[model samples]
Target: MKQIRLGLYQFGDRLIMRARHDWIVWTLVTAEGQARWREERRFPLTVTAAGIVRDLLAS
Candidate 1:
């Protein structure tokens, strides 16, 4: 299983998602900027895109 950590920082109008896994980081910030939320859920990406969406929406 891959480990994922999500960090949300309040800027002006963007929800910044900083995710780190295995020393590699991926980031995405919402253009509208909303309150952030995060959780660790185990799912196979090959099985469904829902997991990807879920992680993003989880904030």
Candidate 2:
């Protein structure tokens, strides 16, 4: 189960956004920016190829 990050934006302190497949894993981290206490959301393989291309470009 491989998850890819599509996009992320900081809303003051917390990070949130969209992703897809394999699949996209959305993590809701502590507002203090700690990864220890976080929740994850799994999305199906529905994100567009362009999104992946954009991710690659950023990478």
lDDT values of the candidates? 0.43, 0.49
Clashes counted in candidate 1 amount to: 0
Per-residue lDDT over 1-59 for candidate 2, one digit per residue giving the tens place of the 0 to 100 score? 42335343344445444454343444555567764323445543335565667777888
For candidate 1, write residues 1-59 as lDDT tens digits. 33334344444434233433312223334556444444444335534465567778888
Worst 10 residues of 2 by lDDT: 1-10
Estimated TM-score per prediction?
0.21, 0.29
Candidate 2 matches the true fold with a TM-score of 0.29
Task: Output the number of the lDDT-best candidate.
Answer: 2
| lDDT for predicted candidate 2 compared with the true structure | 0.49
Candidate 2 collision pairs: 20-23, 20-24
